[model samples]
Target: MNYWLFKSEPDAYSLSDLKNDNNSTGRWDGIRNYQARNLLRDEVKVGDLVLFYHSSCKNIGVAGTAKVVSAPYPDPLQFNPESKYYDPKSSPDKPRWVCLDIQYQQECIKFVPLPLIKATKELDEMILVKRGRLSIQPVSPNEWNIIMKLGKLVC
Candidate 1:
């Protein structure tokens, strides 16, 4: 299964929020970027692993784990005019956005703080480095392996 990373603002939706959801699952929506939307709608599949990264906050890092639980579909928010993520260009007949549902798995117990990632000599070319602000990104196989070796998760 393909591996991926998704970033969310802690104040907007934290790992705890996912854990507390009914069934600990929720749709990942409001993606405005076509690239990110494509990843969710066309590539990500159920059982795929996801790194829940917390961005735009202190201690930005991988906060927990989650797995895709549902098939991709047009993001409802894109059709809702009231939503900040609503897109006027997206028509129901031709959807311009997509989303997925991810089920919470486990927490990392300790933040892998962004600073640490930057300091890691091997992760210099990680997508997170080039696309610092993309809400969703594909993690390279090498990058994933390096992160797994960080040993920062609480035992």
Candidate 2:
């Protein structure tokens, strides 16, 4: 299955929040960017693995692993006028955004911070290290292995 990195602000929805969700699973919603939305709708699939990265925080890095439990579906938040992610241009028949359901897998014993990732030559080509702003990004198997090793988590 394809591997991916899913970034979230710890203050908004941290890995801990996912772990604490009912059944340790929840819908991954609120993706607004076109590129990120496309990835979620097209590339991401159920059973794919995800590196849960905590961004816009003091320790930005892959904090845990999660497994996609559902296929891409229209983001319900987009249809809700009260949601911050709501899109006036989108409708039930034509959705502009998509999301997936992911189940918490395992939290890292030690978070692999950005500095550590940047120091590793093998991870030089990672989109995250390249300052990519997309919330959902594909990850190479090698990169996934390296990050898992660094985070002290079983791959």
Which number leads on TM-score?
2
Q: After superposition, how far is residue 113 of candidate 1 from its true place, in Å?
A: 0.5
Question: What TM-score do all the candidates reach, one by one?
Answer: 0.90, 0.97
Please give the distance, in angstroms, between residue 67's alpha carbon in candidate 2 and its true position after superposition. Answer: 0.4
For each candidate in turn, give its C-alpha RMSD to the true structure in angstroms: 2.0, 0.8
Give the per-residue lDDT of model 2 (tens digit) for 16-70.
9999998999889999999998899889988999999999999898999999999
Q: Model 1 over residues 1-155: C-alpha lDDT tens digits? A: 87788999889888889999989998888788878877787888998888899988877898877889999988888888999989899899998888889999888756677888889989888888766877788887677766766735422
Q: Among all windows of ten consecutive residues in candidate 1, which has the lowest summed lDDT?
A: 146-155
Model 2 TM-score is 0.97
Which ranges of candidate 2 are over 4 A from the true structure? none
